[model samples]
Target: MHRILVVDDEEAIRKNIERLLSLEGYEVATAPNGQHGLVIARSMLPDIIITDINMPGMDGFAMLDAIRHHPELDRAIVIMLTAADERDSMRRGMRLGADDYLTKPFRREELLDAINSQLKKLARFNREKDNAVAKATALTEEKTREHFREQFAGSSFPASQFSGYTPDGSSGFGVSLPPESSSTQTLQATVMFADIRNFTTMAERLSAAELAALLGRYFELACRPVVAFGGTHLKMLGDGLLALFEEDAQPQEDALSHAQRALAASVGIQDAVGSFKQWVQEQYGQRGLPSFSVGIGLHSGEVTLSRLGGMDSPEVTALGDSVNIASRLQAAGKELGWLVVASIDTAQLAGECLRHGRQELVSLRGREKPVAACEVLGISAVPSLQQTHPPFKYDPASLQAAAVQNSEMTARAAKEALKESLWSLQSGSFQSMQQSFRGYQIIRKLGEGGMSDVYLAFSAAQKSEVVLKVLRTSLSNDAEMLRRFIQEYAVLANLTHHHVSRIYDQGFTDDYAYIAMEYLSGGTLKEEIRGRGTPGNSFTGSPAQVHGRVIDLLRQITSALNAIHKLGLVYRDLKPDNLMFRSEGGELVLVDFGIVKNVGEHTVGLMPERLVSTEHGQVIGTPYYVSPEQATGQEVTHRSDFYSLGVMLYEMLTGSRPYKGDSLNELLARHLHAEIPRLPPEHAIFQMLLDSLMAKQAIDRPADAMGIWRGLDILANKTGSLPKARID
Candidate 1:
């Protein structure tokens, strides 16, 4: 498979060498003499070279030297084939970089062995070349420290040149700098703070020496990504790192490059820490190295770069409102689950390549205002650079804006009604149920599932209405599930998206558990579909509009699903009944997370067990929507949701179940063996998506929920009108 080039003056010798090498399975090319061989070497860029030491019109020595000078051919293995046995000739060839010397009339085996050995040596060298590339990439941060010193030496900042250098001097920790004499002298710079989450626990678990060693290695890895983009590490706050960026000394380099580099640094640190955590887990059966996340905040403004303390221990630092706000923005990310939080200014300077991550708002401490921040997915600053960065796109504002607004009319009703009824018995026993029932008007039973009955209730405190779900007493014994349900309330509290139902409060009256949530005026999907059939659902106002509206609803659900999946979890139970259309906003909102599960690499075979308890060696989920693999107890993934969505889509369009069965056993068997229902003639794009989602093989499905969204986007734009409904 390797290419070899042979050169010699004698025609017989060249022919014989080519024939022998060809038999040895090398792709062989040859030149008549040393001069021609040099041309061949330059032209072919062969893996190995063989040439005579003494020859006419430029001997092998000249050819080898010329070949060595060609950058492309220099590393190729060269063997000197010669009639001259003189020590001087061998020395000259070897010095000219001939890899091996094979004298004339040598054994066929000797020639082949020499060729094989030299080829192997070349291979080994190539392997080291690859390893060296990886090592150099890993050393990017290490190299930046020296570069930082040089840049610092040239900068206008006088911190390093100041009089104070002693650790105990005025310039030390908790010290303040004097006010600037002139505002014009201050330079605008972007300050950034990147903190590794949960680092203290890692330190506590590790011995002091181990912790020091780990920190040294981690800092070395972390520091490179920062330096790669031209940011200097200002200081370390325990497990967190702070970096600042200003225009480089060279005016030719834009500040954008520095922002790009900072983004890259964050990515490098993530990769390094991830690999470290994986390594620790593999070697010690413990991922005790620390689970870390990064938050980056950048604000551009005037900042005084200075040095304080005594001459012997001066510390370099930057102090200003810009720097303080950037740090505060980084702190705000802790509450928002953001990895790389940056100010809008930073994002603008960072440019599109770095601006793909989602935006979030956080309420900072001691500040009346909330800061608008964005998370950076990867480094993609320059197009000319290798495009290895993964793309991340999330829009938090769009998601947040979609939530249903509290109508003034309903808001007034809720406040007035809650005060007289359930709000009074917060800490205690259910004294009078008849009084509670009479106090507020329960519009109707919104829904009743296995363990709870939902009712739309009006409150007097806010004078608004809310949905109240009262839990059944029979399920109170399942403490673990109850605890999970309580924990889910906290999770819901943190998520501010509109499609997700907001939990207002939770309480128990003696033997009953209840949760108050946002009231949606529309009925469940199941009720509307059953009452109105396919075209004229009771939920939808018209038949023609229903098809287009349902498609839009699916889009909303898919968007919410995208957000849910981004949190590193899967919503296992995505069924029609769980999706409710809020007629107030004309938006479909996801209501339940009772079956949601955190998914990761190790959760391959675990999801089906949680969703479907084994009843007589059978598992869970309505069999109609259960993926073929899940029916047989196979592992589920994000793709499993696609299958369920496909089933829901079919029902929405055709007013019938895709596959029906008399019992759980029959349903499970039919799901495993039956063909999916045929798509109706209407909505070709919808049919295409449904077919793809219901594909028998998981790999055949779209890679993720986003893929489905993208397809829908294209379809929506291509079709001028919304998809039409088909009715018999």
Candidate 2:
């Protein structure tokens, strides 16, 4: 019987395979790891070996090299067993002279067929050995007369010389081998690295066994794609895999294809790991793993292929700083939030095969020269066929062209068009307004404010509705206002608060400018109060209903203000007009930022032509919401905004301003010293909050928005849940 060996870490799989193969009348032996498997293969000189690719010590790749050098085992067929579904891995196995590869989750019949096929091939080879030797000798005798044939020499690699070392680190090899006296070989190779962005934290979360499992699966996922593009995995780097390419591969196999494969592997790793975590979550909720992000870097260069270390314990390695830099660049991508960064060399080698963006000079450690890299756009080469590809769009150029066209069209339409423009004399210029949005389907006009008109636009890009605010043209030339607007909008964009409106897009137009914001489907609190009026002649009715709604609105507004304050910004105008009610969940979202400013007071920087008006009037704010100090033209801080919120709450409850006037001068006079009437005892927490908010001195108000929100929360809870009571 021909001898066959099976190596696997799993005892059950090893035993089951042994029994199944023995039933077919072939002698079989099993080992758990690379070290033991090599020993058994050497002693037994098995006719064939089947082993798992992933193991604790000296994986299948390492064992293949050990068998390759054995004089007796060199002819042995090796079949790699893996659970991975990547085709690249199968090609890699074949490149290493593996007789065949079998993926796990296999059928019984498939295993039997693979074994029979290999055994039959071995039998056929044996049958031809005598005839082949005779023919070869006859040919050699004829060639012996030739000078080229006579001078040719052959070298032998023996397994006995490598018997001293073990795959496990139990023993060390004491001898080293002399370098091979062979001419250097040049190969076009693509080197790739797939690394975990936050591997340290990931390791902390998983046990040693779990980590090993994750690494195995990760390597399995990464190796297949590399192999598919005619690349071979060199080794594992903790949370990464190193893959190399060879010269004899197809011409179509270039650095670009390999880089794309690396990126794809990175993305696939996330999906596979995510699925695994999801499974764990379903089985054991709290024990589920955390989400992971991956980054990849690829470069191509000349790699010297050589055997390093002692002959008895040599490792297959490609040494060069290019590989190290590629690895580090992958790590650097984590900071840049890029999935893949390809070096300039890789870009050139890959040429048309590489789909990439503009080049960027990346700073690397220990290197004086900054590396020029590009974001790998995708895997496929740009076909000579396509006239224009969507992803290859010139965003800036298109936008500029569109702006110019829109300007010409706007001017033409204004003169010839019959539709009355939204802007009037009071609305000023259409400073930040968008005219033609190709894909945005305008649902309807949401509301019109003093400075801008907002519409509920369904965005095809976001696949959800958004509020597109078209600003009035009057404020466009106010550079000071524009500067403040830009700075405040930028701060708001970076700030992700649950209670605030998320600013998505902002830009300028020739005659207009626009800001696309999150669209809240509900009506404003102002509209809701008008619909759900208090019982006859009352704006503040049942204490339970009225107090609960007032407290809810207060809590939401305060929460939003607190977030803005944390970011060193103060919303000078805080009232119901700026808050929207989300119909879906009754959640309050703070919107509108036409009058926001920095937290601390500062002198306004005037332009050269506008320096004449240095005297500032009562700063622009809603009459009722303006604090006493604000009305007196005094400096304002975050505390001043709290006072406005208090007035806003009072108006929401009573459907009328706490104080009002027909003229600006009269309004400022009343706001500076007028006493806020106390709410009846039945108003519950409203009176206490109002006392603090309407405090004559800014310091007398609550410390911050949080204090106000917290107090409101207590009142809200005391109102007995207030189910079905919409705060709006």
Q: Tell me each candidate's TM-score.
A: 0.37, 0.38
lDDT of each residue in 1-728, candidate 1, tens digit only:
46688888778777767755653445689888888887766656677888877678888888888878974566678888766457788888788887888877777668877876665454333333323322332233222333333433333332231111111111111111223332213566677776555443333334444444555555556655554555542343334456665645554423345556556666677777777765555543342233444556666556665543333222345666677677677655544445667777767767777745556554554455666667677765464222422222222232121111101211222223323222333333233223253234566676555345678887554468887776532212233345344435544655567777777765543234567778776756766667654455533454345556656766777877776666555666678778776773455678876656556432212122232122232233555678876677666678888888888888777677788864455666777777866876664557778888888878998888778877776666665436331110
What lDDT score is found at residue 362 in candidate 1?
49
lDDT agreement with native, every candidate: 0.57, 0.57
Residues 440-513 of candidate 2: C-alpha lDDT, one tens digit per residue: 77777776543446788988878999888765322222333343344435555666777778887765432334
Off by over 4 Å in 1: 1-158, 161-186, 200-209, 224-233, 248-261, 264-295, 304-321, 328-338, 351-517, 520-590, 593-728
Candidate 1 has its poorest 10 consecutive residues by lDDT at 398-407
Error of 2 at 520 (Å): 1.5
Q: Which residue runs of candidate 2 sit more than 4 Å off their true CA positions?
A: 1-435, 472-476, 484-488, 534-541, 600-618, 713-728
lDDT of 1: 0.57
